[model samples]
Target: MITVVVFFSGSGIGTSTQMQHNNQASSSARERHPNSQIPLPQSNYAKHESGATRDSRRRKLKKQKVRPEKRKAGNLEYTNERNIAAHVSRGNKDRPIHKFKNSFVCYSNNARTKAVAVVKFYPFEGMDPERKAHYEQLSTNLIAHTRFQNAKKSNENTLGGTMYSLGWRKGFEEKSHLGITGIASKVAKDQEGWIKLFTETPWINDFLAQRFQDISLGMYREVKEQYDQQKAPSLTPFYMADPESFCGHLSFTFDNFYNKAHKDEDASPFRFAMWIPINKQTGKLVEENLQVEGGEFVFPEDGCAIDFSGFNGVVECVWKASEHPHHTLPSSTAIGSSDDRLGLSCLLPDSAERAIERMMAVEDGEKLDWTIQDLGHLHNDSLKYDSKGKPFETNDGVDLQASPPSACVLDEDSSTEPDKSLSSQLKVATPTQLHRST
Candidate 1:
């Protein structure tokens, strides 16, 4: 019987054979060990590669392949500097959207001392036909003004400070060199005119200051009258609803240069007063009077007052109202000063009430009580006064003559009565006590 022997070797057998070979080799190597033994042969199939060595070899190869002509000097340095600057400047570019182009300079003393310098750059997008036509006319007019051209030559301080001119091809060259174009020319011209007007004209500055003062005063008077009419006892709680609006009076007063000491003892070089309106909803002062030209709105040791200068040369006044009296300490919570009385007055009683009602109803209304007071007082103070130091009164109770002595005092012990003619029929008492019983 020819029976073929069937033999099946499992995968484990192959592993066993490999293990046996490894063990035999290790044993032989151990047996051959000596004081100075030869190292075992390394397997060519078991090569060890290091990342550092591989990278070095790659770099060497790359360098060898690149031509010397292709290399640039300082290129790497420039790239590094550029990258660092870009990283540093990234935050600046992401600044708040409301950032002002001009720096605002605020002054507590004089409006003329305040200035704003704004820089604006313009480039051409698509031009409007009307704008282009306007520019063309403007350019023509500029050229027609020979005096302007002569002024440019004679006065080095004139428009010559700018780069563009209507002269030669060299003018165009300068334009191109500075990257200026038609649009840039137009912008420069407009800006130059504005700068000149702002910097060179005193009357212009005064006019602007006067206008701002007037507007501020008008707003303050209206607000004060509204508060008075409401007859609210105090304005100490409404600061949160609109802190900005409530503080508008303070800002206006400060800006107009109203001195607070004027209302203290009538000793200030300038006369002033302040009329603050309290918000009914929040019970905090809403707004103050704007400083007028002749009289000044001032805060007394107590309530507020607008002291006039000899009746009406220029009305200067400031008005401020807060939830708490600004000049007083927390421990001393009394209202009214030694000089001025506190209480709502008829002069502007309904002013505050009307304003509050309108504000609640979300309507816009305005009154000019402060202006009337300013002008009327000035007119009445101009009337003649009697020997008793009382201003001569008319049948209509309006003073038609200027006070005999402009330096007449309105103190308490003085039997001198205010010329009734000069006083407004409407008088609003403050909420606080009068500093002196008049």
Candidate 2:
């Protein structure tokens, strides 16, 4: 199948090598020699049970004829890296819907562009604790943001604009180059670092290569040539040698499971090129949120939807976005669901380089706003104002300096809240501007 996507499901193993090893072990154990009894892993639900007690429980379930999908994929317990396999699918699995861009012959399970297909990664066993914790905390932050704990209070009631965007450049206007102008990063460096999260992800990069290898090999080779000239001598193919020629962009949409159904106008030069970044653990969180609310991904054209509500498998999805006209279902979960429903868009180095060039060449590189335009390499749209009627800046906007502050998107790990006045806040809609939304 034309599955050029690797989702970080349950455990987020380091590489394919680890995946093969785990799968092989599972296969070997399943090769039961006609009579020998095999034991399932200890489940969290019965962690306190003695061996005999667990064995008795399994016997009971077996006698009851329990199916694999009704519970975990394996006999593993309810750990964070629980290998439930929680597999889900939709549409006709049989038959190819025509070869996608035909670099090689393959069919995409998610190939139904009009009706976007959502599938998750094959589950693996055991995950690193640190990584698991990282995902949990991120989810916590997302929920907190939604609850207003992380929100900077705002009183602006004017028309910001019609287009909404995420990610911003430091010391620059909020609405330039893939920007939602008034929304600045609480910490400057976070902008760049967020972009790297997807570009450097092992599976993400590998899958990107696998899915588009033939069509993109020539383009990758061209960059690899110049990457060879770097002085630091990093061995990775997608190394960040320089922002202009290297670097990437990661823009995202954060909301609950419910929203208006509209075509994702992301087919713009930089958007159709982006991909989703989700590892196993993060995928689990997304699925759980889906269960609470916002039950499915809907295709507006035919009003067809794949019910994703209630842990119905929210996992890694990859597509040639430009080729798809799609929209997603609003989340069902709301309270304490800051990190619940998320859609991320990423720009790898090749795309970023081209975007940066276009950004620099804007207005013959003369727009004073273009000084920090490189930030758009990741976010791609550096327009001071989206083509709509409103301006990006408000009379009371934060007073930024001519030169960007030394702190930037990459340095967000130790982010200290910038002055509350400069922090980004959800724009409060006034009675008059209620017609426009951010």
* Model 2 misplacement above 4 A: 1-118, 121-131, 137-247, 257-291, 300-306, 312-314, 334-339, 347-355, 359-369, 373-438
The true-versus-predicted C-alpha distance at residue 96 of model 2, in Å, is 19
lDDT of all the models against the reference?
Answer: 0.26, 0.32
Q: For candidate 1, what is the TM-score?
A: 0.15
lDDT per residue (tens digit) for residues 269-382 in model 1: 111122222222222322223122222222233222233322211122222222112221111112331111111111111223233233233222332111111212222332
Q: In candidate 2, what are the lDDT values of residues 204-266, reduced to their tens digit?
A: 334333322222333334334543332111112121232122113333344332334443323
Candidate 1, after superposition: displacement of residue 342 in Å?
30
User: TM-score of predicted model 2?
Assistant: 0.35
